[model samples]
Target: MRKITKGIAPVSFMEWVRQKPRNVDDNQWFQELYKQKRWDIVSDLSHHNAREQFYLCAYCCSEISGEGQETVNEHVEARALASHRSLDFTNIVASCKTKGQCDAHHKSQALPLTPLMDECETEFHFKISGRVEGKSARAIESIRVLNLGDNERNNKSLIEKRKQLSHNLMMANGLDPDEGLEDDELLLAVIDDLLTPTEGRLSPFAPVVANILRSWISG
Candidate 1:
């Protein structure tokens, strides 16, 4: 639900796309290119090739810490046919969302929601219990298709992090850390208080997640 800014494509990447033949629009062809080198086009497209690829989990938006970092996967945004048929930036999303399963579910309905598609905020909400349920059927389906709901450990870890951040914020504001609040309440309070529109920030997903938390708490 939040916008991710860290691994955003650079202007140079657009230039590279421009330099590549506009006629090179074939799904199979791009698939072969991806097979040859996973991020050949991506490297040319973005300056955030280093840390951005490794630290962020594509699905749950959890920071892949400790051993998770080693096991973390960075999936190229293109499907063979999907890429070849279209060269638009929206089609290419660097995601940690794929959870090692492929099925009819993996294929997007139409313009599958990824971090690059910012407006997805309207689709889902986070619960105070740290559960991410969809605001609609499409949102629920998207969460399932991407295996977002299956990663219980990742979600719990993020919720705990939100808790700690909330506690710290309350303490800084001269409020008791144990102010008769449940875990979700404290977390939502922190998000509502601290997160605001910041310029040139990374991780748009953070706010979306926070908003979901807020919705859950308020509800």
Candidate 2:
């Protein structure tokens, strides 16, 4: 996962929250916000977070598309745990639809690593075979909790997709795995492109792709 720099909360949402009755209970206020069907606020938050995350899921790095349930405004600290921050802008992220896997299905389970934190990118290791393993206990917990590598629910799992993407990237760059060309400048350029982060778009499972590419060339 990549780090997302939380942007300012939408002014409209801020105003709405500020206008709420001061004595309202936090949980009640949260319920009210949902009951109001203030999807405009949710849309605003999703768009902003989608951009910040380069249009990828904050948890599994899947490409987020469409306005349907495939993409959702996921609360970083679940509303159940932090009802007080329900409307807090920084507490939300854009994640792929949770159809048994992904972020939305995980609920309030504690994460060992979060994209909000800088070091999260390095907390897991990706294998060329499409397997993902945590670098620490916390990272392991995060993987299981998020179902980052789960393949049971769907025919294609997160790791499987990542492996395909990596292979495609290699093929697109004309890098041959069967040959030993570690010092080739063209190969290095290909690896660099995979490693570099873009401003408004990130390749799915970019970190995993980059790491695998680096190992391929170095080996």
What lDDT does each candidate get?
0.47, 0.71
Model 2 scores a C-alpha lDDT of: 0.71
User: Per-residue lDDT tens digits of candidate 2, residues 1-219?
Assistant: 777889787687777778778898655765676688877766766777787777888887778762546788777777778788776778878899957666655788766578888777777776766777788898887778878773434325665677788667666667654453566566667757865667767677766666555555654
User: Once model 1 is optimally superposed onto the true structure by TM-score, how far is the C-alpha of residue 26 displaced, in angstroms?
Assistant: 3.8
53-116 per-residue lDDT for model 1 (tens digits): 3333445544433132222223324354355434454444344323432222355344355555
* Candidate 2: stretches off by over 4 Å: 25-28, 150-156, 176-181, 184-192, 195-199, 214-219
What's the lDDT for residue 57 in model 1? 41
Question: Each model's TM-score, in the order given?
Answer: 0.54, 0.82
Root-mean-square deviation of every model:
6.6, 3.2
How much is the lDDT of residue 75 in candidate 1?
32
